[model samples]
Target: MPVLSLAPRRSGFGTELLTQTVPYQLRGTTTLTFKPGGLQCTIELPAKELLQ
Candidate 1:
């Protein structure tokens, strides 16, 4: 399993700041399968990122 961290953005007083906590949105499907070694893990990136 992989851990992800995100931070939100805050804006006020003509200044912008990043929040300590943010929300995460998964872009792909998650499937679990048993393997001889153990378990397999896979994650897909969002389409928006690909454009960049």
Candidate 2:
């Protein structure tokens, strides 16, 4: 298993940018469904499901 994080990295000119270690938008479609007791999410993903 691999570890996932959301920290920005320093780029040229001292600018901060998100690392592309994992796909955040998930094919540009990130969906989240919330219910009374639980929640549901839908994202077009790859072979590995990245979760915290």
Worst 10 residues of 2 by lDDT: 13-22
Using all chains and alpha carbons, the TM-scores for the candidates as numbered come to: 0.35, 0.31
lDDT of 1 at 52: 66
Residue runs of model 1 more than 4 Å from their true location after superposition = 1-24, 49-52
Candidate 2: C-alpha RMSD to true structure equals: 12.7
* Maximum-TM-score candidate: 1
Model 2: per-residue lDDT, tens digit, 1-52? 4333432243443121112322454423434454454435454556454352
**What TM-score does model 1 achieve against the real structure?**
0.35
Candidate 2's displacement at residue 37, Å, is: 1.9
Ten contiguous residues with the weakest lDDT in model 1? 14-23
The segments of candidate 2 whose C-alpha lies over 4 angstroms from its true place after superposition are 1-26, 46-52
* RMSD of every prediction: 13.5, 12.7
